[model samples]
Target: MSFEQFLFYFFSVVLVGAAVAMITVRNPVHAALFLVLAFFTSAAHWIMLEAEFLGILLVLVYVGAVMVLFLFVVMMLDINVARVREGFVRLLPVGLVVAVGMMVVMAMVVGARVFQVESPGRADGDYSNTKAIGELLYTEYVYPFEIAAVILLVAIIAAITLTLRRRPDSLYMDPAEQIKVQRKDRVRLIKMEAEKK
Candidate 1:
C-alpha cells in the first residue's frame, strides 16, 4: 500500500479506538482524554486530505482549548461513578438497539454511490482547499455563516446568563470604578505613637 493509504488506515483505526475508549471508559477524565485522542486522530486524517487549515484549526480549537477545558471540568467535578453505572445494565439493551440502528443507517447512506464522484484532476499541490472553502463561505454561504455565528453567540450569552449568580454577601467591584479610584480608598493612614523599645 502507498504511504497515504497506510496513514489513512492508521488514523482511521486510532480514531475508532479512541471513540470506543471514550464511550467505554468508566472514568470521566479518561473518557475526556480518549476524546482528545479521537480529535487528534481526526485532525491527522484532515491533514492527510490536504486540509491544512481545518486540521490545524481542529487541533488548536478542539484539542487545545475545548478538550483542555473539558479535562479540567471533568477533574474538578465530583461525579459518582457507582450511581452512573447503576443504570448501565437497564439501559444497555436500548443503547445497543439505537447504536445498531444508527450504524445501519450510516452504512446505507455513506455506502451509496452518490458520493462516489470522480476525483478532481489536480496535482498534489495544484489547488488550495482552504481558498475554495473561503470563497464559498464568503460568497454563497455568507448568510448561513452569519446566522450560525449569531446562534452561537446567543447560546454563549444564554449559558452565561443561566449560570451567573449574584451572591448577596460577596463583595464585588466595578472595573470602571476601580480604574478611576483615588489612592485614598486603597491606602489608609493612621497616626500612632512610635513604638517604645
Candidate 2:
C-alpha cells in the first residue's frame, strides 16, 4: 500500500476508535475530549482529500466553537455518570440496531462501487474554493443555510434558557422603574434630629 493509503487507514482507525471512546467513556468531560479527537481526525481526512477550506472549517467551526461549547457544558453540568448509565443496558439493543442499519446503508452505498474513481489530476489553476462556496451558499443553498442558522440560534437560546436561573433573594433594579423615576423619587427631603455623637 502507498504511504497515503497507510495514513488513511491509520487515521480512519483512530477516528472510529475516538468516536467509540466518546460514546463509551464514563466521564462526560473525557467523552467530549475524545469527541474532539474524532473531529480532528475527520478534519485530517478532509485535508487529505485536498479540501483545505472544508478541513479548516471543520477545525474552526466544530472543533473550535461547537466542541468547546459542548466540552464546557459537559464540564459545568457535572452530569451523573451512574444515572446516565442506568438505562444503558435497556437502550443497548436499540443502539445496536441503529448502528447496524447505518452500517448496512453505508456498505450498500460505498461497497457497491457506486462511486467510481478517476485518476488524480492537477488542481484547477483558476478555481477558487471560497468563491465557489460563497456562490453556492448565497444562490442555490441560501434557504437551507438560513434554516440551519435559525436552528442553531434557537439551540443557543434554548441552552441559555435551560441553564439560566433566578435568585429570589437577590435584588435587582428594574430599568423601566429607574427610567420612570422623577426628581422627587430620587431626592427625599428628610427632617433629621441633630444629636451629639
Q: Highest TM-score, which number?
A: 1
TM-scores for all candidates? Answer: 0.81, 0.77
Off by over 4 Å in 1: 111-114, 124-126, 174-197
Per-residue alpha-carbon lDDT of model 1 for 151-188, expressed as tens digits? 99999999999988999998988999879999998999
For lDDT, the strongest prediction is 1
Against the reference, the lDDT scores of all candidates come to 0.90, 0.88
Candidate 2 per-residue lDDT over residues 87-147, each given as its tens digit:
8888999999999999999988886654766634447687766676789799999999999
- Model 2: CA > 4 A from native: 109-123, 150-173, 187-197
Give the clashing pairs for model 1.
none
Candidate 2 C-alpha error for residue 88, in Å: 1.7
Which residue window of length 10 is worst by lDDT in model 2? 113-122
